[model samples]
Target: MTGKTVGVLGFPFSKGQPKGGTELAPKELRAAGIVDRIQALGNNVIDHGDVDLSGLPADSKVGVAKNSLAVGEANKKLSEDVAKYLKKGEQVLLLGGDHSLGIGSLHGHTQVQPDTVVVWVDAHADLNTPFTSDSKNMHGMPLAYVVKEMAQFLPKTPGLEWCKPSLSTKDIVYIGLRDVDPGERKFIEQLGISCFSMHEVDKFAIKDVVEKALSQVDPSGNRPIHVSFDVDAMDPIHAASTGTKVPGGLTLREAFYIAEEIAATGRLSVLDMVEVNPKLGSPEEKEVTVANTVSVTAKFYGSKRQGDVPPNYVIPRPQA
Candidate 1:
């Protein structure tokens, strides 16, 4: 409760990938009592509401990357907002518009603590660049944008680039990685980013992996941390509402363990729960799944909401 303040920011932009229901994620999660859920967790919760990620022109002057303007614009604002909250001493919980939102969230967090290390929890590697991503989905390209300074090949935009180009190669770690494209795989190798794939989890156990992860965070024990979590990182059996659901992800219990340990570390600052697609789930199941998500999120934040808010506060944009 003392490490950081808690702020929720919802982003409804889901066009970053091949998904439609993510735009409805915040609304569905709200109905499922996300605010009340946080309130129940005993942490101070403030919902700054969702950022406006609507109304993008059909055409982007940029080639290769789809919806570059929309994605970039929303992320720019998201980054600014996230930066604002960290400045206010709030622990940021950025609800997913999609995984691509990580670019903005990380940018904002790093703007404050440029040395912050990010623990990326997702089923996919998320290391794909526009040139290599066969899917052409911007969701898969955040890592590329953040780590590739000259890689900001936004063919059309007039230099509003906030790309970080290789966020301290030592600063990024990957856990729960099982699915990855060949190009992304090569990039990971080329960058020397640490990754504990599902295979590693099987051989070494979650606790060991987490311990190794913390060691990688900062050998000096001083850098801040940002957790970029893709809900799809969990086994799809737990919540099959994301666009990129893959098999063999972390169990619910294991996820909570990782989060709890991170919270206890005091270095945990911002957390991102991305790729929740309400449109993909059945009505009743959607409600139940979202409730679980908020619960998991609260554990990472340490406590829940207070007297004025509901149990599950909508976690939209990251900046308070």
Candidate 2:
């Protein structure tokens, strides 16, 4: 494992979604020892605390997007923060309020590494633009704002101007998809974006699927990688605490393998795990889901399940 400095940024704002309580994830995950576990892997973990967006100024709603003004303002700040950290060469672990935060995260990541590859792990394809969105929930429309083809359709909102198609369709791939919307499905098909649904995972297996995905996104194996993980990608049995639950999703082991494969590349720059809503499930369900999220995150930072030898070992007892 490469011991790069890790910057943890938490977005506790949940205005992007139509639900409540996802805003509590950052605090809960921190309390569950996310930072300390990364530190155990020998990486320097810096907790940047949470991005508070409760009192931020918002603009008028734009077109069909809900909370467009608030989401834009918050994402603008998040993008700036992400850019600053990446510029300093620190790997970022963004604790998200929802998948909607992806807009800001990708915007900021691309500002530093324009050719960064995005790996989206989710049951739903969040590729709906404001114009195509039926729910008007900004969380489901984040990818639309960051795709090159959809840029012209985006409104010229004040805080959202900084967002552009920092990512091309070829540079982005999706895994664990099962609940894609009709519009998103058409968009993905038309753009020929690489996607591995549960059916593909069962056919090709996770390892092969990941290898193929890497080949498509990082053919030369030199681009920076950003993984956006939505907890809903996991089967509801393993992650019942998330807002949107899909029945047949990735197993816990499969989810960890995905993170492990990305970490093994040693090119991972930013990781955002979102959509974990503690308020939606029972106490046991909440605990299990949170634990699963923490473990997957730890694996991304090289947390060896079997542990490892200390690098700086002085002779505590001299060998004879």
Candidate 3:
């Protein structure tokens, strides 16, 4: 088990999607005993109650980007919260409201670890800017705002001024991407971001894909890793509760292995498990999704089951 102190920041604020119940994810996950489970893993876990963005009006939408102000304000607050824990040398598990929370979670991570390597595991590239997003969803455009190369092309949204482009295209890697908009594709190709799509996963298998991904992002294997995992990255069978369901995606085993491998590196300092929407599925589906998400988080803290034998243990065989 990791010896690091873990700060669990539950961000139940979800204005990123055009739906409800996603904001309730933090509560549901907590109810499922995330804090207790992490504590059981021999790590010091602090539950920093769900972020308070209630003061921000829900009906507020600004410019071409729907809910731009609300999303921006919430992210700004979240950035401050995350930065606090990082400044104190504590690892963070940000139970996300939506994938849009990436704007804040990743930004806050960079405050302390400027050279952090982001492993963005999701179905969509999320590289759309306000000008390019046909749906005007802030979640789809988060990476565009944070990437320095695309900043000039994006218009200034209400709460985005506090956010500067902190991630160069090379500082991040994308995995489990099966869906991409035309604009997002063009931007990704032009910038030459390292992406391991579902096609690559099928061709090279997850292990090799992860190896190549890590090599691209952290060639020296020294920078801290921040894994922003969207539940939609999994196939609909495993994670049907998420809003965006791509047919072919990572299996439960593949997802867990990715998390475990990163944890083993001893450089996983931040995590964002986002986009598990309870309202989108049946009760059983919700349970499975939440359980799977929790399971992945467990792996992030070094839960390797039978393989995690006590290092100092010697078989106390009977004197035969």
Candidate 4:
């Protein structure tokens, strides 16, 4: 994060899920000053505007990957754009419409770093493939594309036609997962990917958990790390405006602590504040959506209280 130019890129396609709340996330968050907040961190911040999806559904009709072709197109363009920023030695903060944006961002970062690590924070594994996904939402399948696990099912596109693995399975560390899909769970287990489910978070602690995630993502001397943060990863109490709010998510303090600690590492290259929905819960919930998103983004950018103490996160070793 040191000497990195911060750029804001928006991905406003959210047909990936049944809910349509995420399309408004960027606009709402902008009005709440997410851009201004980034500039205050003393970094060269620039907003690259949003991708023009041309109102295509998350999937397309021209590919075997059903509904996922258009998703690939948008993501490929996003990857190209974000890759340019990364190549310029900039820290790109992607404003996501849903977790689906991870596809493009991951592609972009991997194209530049080639060996970057991804720390996916969410309430679900999001590793489902076209064959495995019962819901067919492209959002839940981004990790599948990022990891290059299933190539045969992917659509054929110029830059995205082939599956070049982004982050390795072992390199990925999923934190704050709870309501994972069944097939997705088997995929994660088969891959032996590191994960700290909500049960683990409750048993151990957030501090230790964050430490473990950070270590796994960057064991080789703090290489470039991308954090794809989905607001639903936080406990529903902390963020109830998400389209897919799961119970028992990371608390606001714990979520911010992740950002703060990751920023402290200085190896953190890309920061994504995703899944901030403005159309959920009571009136109070929408109001808090941007605030929580802003808080975590601030923490990621080296903003913190002088005497604030990190949380006591107990990260117990996995059972062999």
Top candidate (TM-score): 3
Using TM-score as the yardstick, the better of models 2 and 4 is: 2
Task: Give TM-scores for every candidate, taking all chains together and pairing residue i with residue i.
Answer: 0.88, 0.94, 0.95, 0.88
- lDDT score, candidate 4, position 132: 73
**Segments of candidate 4 deviating more than 4 angstroms:** 1-3, 55-66, 152-163, 307-320
Off by over 4 Å in 3: 57-62, 307-320
Per model, how many backbone clashes are there?
Answer: 30, 0, 0, 10
Measured with C-alpha atoms, the lDDT of residue 232 in candidate 3 is 91
Q: Is candidate 1 or candidate 3 better by lDDT?
A: 3
In model 1, the runs with Cα more than 4 Å from the true position are 2-4, 60-62, 148-160, 164-166, 303-320
Candidate 4 local lDDT, residue 194: 88
Give the alpha carbon lDDT tens digit for every residue of 38-127 in model 3: 777777888888777878745443576888878888999999999999998899999978889999988888888899999999999988
Residue-by-residue lDDT tens digits, candidate 4, 187-285: 788878889988888887988898877776667655888899999999888788988888888989888888888888787777777887777788898
The per-model lDDT (C-alpha) reads 0.77, 0.88, 0.88, 0.77
lDDT of 3 at 21: 79
- Model 1 lowest lDDT segment of ten: 150-159
Predicted candidate 2 versus true structure: per-residue lDDT over 26-53, tens digit per residue: 9899999999888877888899898767
Clashes of 1: 30
